[model samples]
Target chain A: MVGSALNQIEIRRLVKAFGNRAVLKGVDLTVAEGEFLTLVGPNGAGKTTLMNVISTLTKPTGGLVRVAGYDLADGAVAVRRQIGLVSHKTLLYDDLSAEQNLRFYARMYDVPNVEARIETVLRRVGLWGRQRDPVRTYSRGMQQRLAIARAMLHDPPILLLDEPDTGLDQHAAAMLTDLLHEVGATRRTVLMTTHNLDRGLELGDRVAILAGGRIAYQAAKSELDAEQFREVYYQYVKQRV
Target chain B: MPLIMPYLRKVFAIVAKDVVAELRTREMLSSMFVFSLLVILIFNFAFDLRAENQKTLAPGVLWVAIAFAGMLGLSRSFIMEKDRGSIEGLLLTPVDRSAIYLGKMLGNVLFISVVEIVILPIFVVLFNLSARDLPLLVGVMILGTIGFAGVGTLFSAMVIHTRAREVLLPILLFPVVIPVMLSAVKLTAAILDRLPFADVQNWFSLLVAFDAIFMALSFILFDYVMEE
Candidate 1:
């Protein structure tokens, strides 16, 4: 499940270290075009770091990372145009309305037909009614929905969600699950990092466990047994801990 | 024209976004304005600014107030982005990294200039100073602000992730920005004194040179500073 020739994202021997400490040590992973990959990892297991490197937010220390066939080294700007990220942080201006926030990002991404696209995304995330209200006034769930709207506003083919459900309540998380389902329905290549085993297994076509700064285990969802995989997840995570 | 238009548009987008955000919350401008006003008020009352010494004292006091208040605005410029994690949002875009720097620097200049515009007239009244050379003084201040905001914007991004960014920004910023302030103060004093432009031509050249140097340096270095 790791290697697919000519995939949308291909990471070979990916190394990411912070000075003396290494977070991701020679990670090898790939997500084919239109495939959803859920990377499950324990706390401090470099999930966000991997997402950051892929999104061109964090530069990798070593190894080849190619996104949408563009290398991270020389083609970061090109890669940025190909991916949209939804991190735990909302990444929004609280003072700006939802519409304004989208407009700002639309201009940044050079999105075509800005107003219409903003409306389309806002409607997709069910935030069109509150488009004019300040983001600071939004609940955690609403903010996450707006974040999804933001990520999709540019219509990038690849989506990277790094623990986007981190701060949401149960009801909001469920709503997020629904939103994720809708996003998955679009057949966009998505790489989501999650600690929620149930949601992780449910959403991804393939689920991979990240432990010891590497892909410890992985399998296609059709080939996985939920109970056995839960045992395997805890085993890998506990070993790292 | 084809290549530059998109770049300029992106830069304008960032500036426009900052303006909209600031207008909505009044977070950056109001604080900067009030703080600058207070600095002038404190100096005015403390020194008993009289017409005799006001000319000499005004340059240092004015620059000090503007620099300090500008620091507040500059610190908040990236801090706002970092606080909401919107800096990453900006970085994730395909726009050139230098465009982000320029936009942020321009936004800072605009905020600082607004603070200066409001405070200058009040400063003149408070110090019992003349308004004859006000335009020239404004020109000097704008040049100083471009330099100030240029270096300040770069340093603000450098310290955005630090635990003590609010404190660290001034420590890192003031030393680098001393030349800008010095030139500005010199020109301000020269203008108010109605000194021949030939006499102070050196300072004017120095101000313009530093503005160009700072902006160019910041623009070139911003990508490195922003990279993790």
Candidate 2:
């Protein structure tokens, strides 16, 4: 996991501090190409901060971070071209219809064959039937699914999701799980931060626990038992708390 | 660098999307139109706007209405994006960041200009400006609105994430846009008074120069401001 396959993300001694407080202090993590890595962390554990850095939304204070083989410092525009981000919020205009939102993004991303791509993503997210409806009228689950479609429209090699399941109900959460399953099969490198331990661990090929502004533990999903993982999770969290 | 056509096309796409959104709800436009009308009505009654007062006071009053109404629209430009969290999505797009500013400024200009167009004829009757000045008035309005909207759009976006943005926008905007308003008011007054172009050419130059400066500054600063 450290350096074998084509690495999509390589972060070494990454530091992000706001004023006097450092949210991420010297973090190092690597995600292989096409790997599904779920990072479970508590609030203020720097999980979102790392995702922001990778997405080029936040500039790192120190250390090196490479996404899709582009350095985070100088290659932001290039990195942006190679990644798509889905945050907790839907980020779609409420008044715009689903079709309009997708098409708007499609044009902004300069996607060719815009009509075809919008249709493809809309259908994939099961929103094509209601594509003409305003996004304001959509349910939370539907919006999240449409967000998935939106993030995938440009077909970037890497995807970054931050607390996407925060506001979803059980049914919607299950739908998201299924959607992620289908998405993971495409061999896109995904780095998702989640609080839902059960579901998070279930979907990831590898799981990492982040606490105390750093990744405390990481292992392949098959290598750790569920009960043992719970013990290890709390053990790391207890020390940090 | 990316192709210029694609860059320009993205700017238009943002404008179209905003126009469609505004048309659906009429949120910003309706408020702006009504507000502009209210300002005019208040001035009509407040000042004893007789024939003598109409020349100086009316031009000032008309500009006051347009500037405040434009502010009403500009204040919401980025507020909508902030509320819906769409600003982040816009920034995440691969297009040039300046294109976003241009697109948003275009929408604001369109919105403010619409309000101006609706109120101008009414302004003529209320203030007794002859219809002969209509052509010149239209030109002045375009130049004035561009400068106003350019500065307003930038300041509004700058304060979008501030806690007191609703209160902050006018306070931050009015001072910076005072130069624009001054030139516009002087230009409109010159036209109404039947002054020679020589008297107003300086004002027109100032208006265009302010607009060009503001547009360029906003274009360069938008990317930095948008960074979280």
| Candidate achieving the largest DockQ | 1
DockQ of each: 0.89, 0.73
- After best superposition, candidate 2 residue B104: deviation in angstroms? 0.5
Question: Model 2 chain A — which ten-residue stretch has the worst lDDT?
Answer: A1-10
Worst 10 residues of 1 chain A by lDDT: A1-10
Query: Interface RMSD, all models, one decimal each?
Result: 0.8, 1.1
lDDT of 2: 0.89
Task: Rate residue A223 of model 2 by lDDT.
Answer: 92
What stretches of model 2 exceed 4 Å from their correct place? Answer: A1-5
True contacts kept of each: 0.98, 0.75
- Candidate 2 C-alpha error for residue A138, in Å: 1.2
Q: Which pairs of residues collide in model 1?
A: none
Compared with the true structure, what per-residue lDDT tens digits does model 1 show for residues A120-183? Answer: 9998888989999999999989999999999999899999999989989999999999999988
- Residue-level lDDT for B212 in candidate 2: 93
